[model samples]
Target: MLGDGSLGNVGSPPRVGCVAGVFDLFHVGHVDVLERARRHSDRLVVAVLSDEWAMDAWGARPFVPLLERAQIVEHLRCVDEVVAVDDVRPEWLTGVLGVQTVFAASATDGVLGVDELDGIPPGLITVLPAGRGSRSPILRAAIDQRQSRSSVA
Candidate 1:
């Protein structure tokens, strides 16, 4: 568990599943995806995107820092392990982390953009539907922007 600051292997499960994301502002949608992913495999590994990757990919730095985001994810019951990932490439997740299945939220509910799915086999990926707890980081960001502007005005 990354919360304890240890990256020790949790031993191989019947199936090892992975979900990678920035996890900038933890929300119900994040919990929804993690718990759902855990159901598909015996163990779940969450990859918290590094600050650099989040900034470069989104053109905006994460509201929460990388290590903090990782620690938050590590404490989740559904996650067996949390790792810091600079890249979302399939080879890195499979070759390095030994992930058997990759769980991802659909475009509307996805923190990881579609480009991150490139090169991964379709069969190896599980796309969770946009659930009641949908990923609305964009909406959150807009609200924050409006609030900030009002405050300044």
Candidate 2:
């Protein structure tokens, strides 16, 4: 789904929940967060960061492109909808999709800091536990190391 596009299921959609991430490598951590988010809401809406925005925010381009990433996320069992967004504007995303709860898998001091969640209502944001103690930065570093080693050998 691009922009506000959504994927519909055969059953009635329930409460709206939104989760945003780069989802570059689409690893187990991403799966963990998405699964937890689905448990909280009947309808889970995911927002994937664009490659350009990812570079600006995370200082690295996604290995998987935005449209492809969106397609990958759309196919996930935990996701009811997938949105390709430029930035991680959680407040705007919540408002746009009528999201009841915003699920975050990042540390408060790191990615999902207070500044990114300014306009969202209190208690609406649920900070989920990290998956295998891994986040984007850690995953990216691991991938980079592998790539470097491969290139060296």
Candidate 3:
């Protein structure tokens, strides 16, 4: 278990879990979320949103390329599977992965625009709070400030 409660296994039915994200900048917060998801099930499956999907939702290309982001997550010891999420509905992900639980950042406010997930199969959803100072807003602000300073200098 990494931290959130997922157990690792080799054989037998894996108690699979899922977490979906754009993972745009791949910061420490992203690491914390993935590590936590790994602790909640026997296997943690990470879904990295495709660049097109992310741009549609968030309006910009990610700092890292989609393949690079997926590879980074795949290499983590806590992640069991890494897949691309090209659709908007994350609930569909639980079904596709046969996951026991789906993890997300609590700060996301269940606002994935998918109607209530109550009826979805493989039905369990958990939202982990963002780690201290680990958020996209904070990271974005820092980047902007740094750029401003460098430009001024």
> Could you say which candidate leads in lDDT?
1
How many clashes does the backbone of model 2 have?
0
The residue-by-residue lDDT of candidate 3 on 5-33, one tens digit each, is 43344455767877777777766767777
Candidate 2 Cα misplacement greater than 4 A, ranges? 1-13, 107-121, 133-139, 142-153
Worst 10 residues of 2 by lDDT: 1-10
Q: Each model's TM-score, in the order given?
A: 0.78, 0.71, 0.71
lDDT (C-alpha, whole model) for all candidates: 0.77, 0.71, 0.67
Best-to-worst order by TM-score is: 1, 2, 3
* Better candidate by lDDT, 1 or 3: 1
- lDDT for each residue of candidate 2 in 45-141, tens digit (9 for 90 to 100): 8878678877887687888888888998899987888888877564576668878788766642122433455565667888777555445667668
Off by over 4 Å in 3: 1-12, 88-95, 108-123, 142-153
Report model 1's TM-score to 2 decimal places: 0.78
**Model 1: how far residue 132 lies from native, Å:** 2.6
Q: In model 3, how large is the Cα lDDT of residue 98?
A: 75
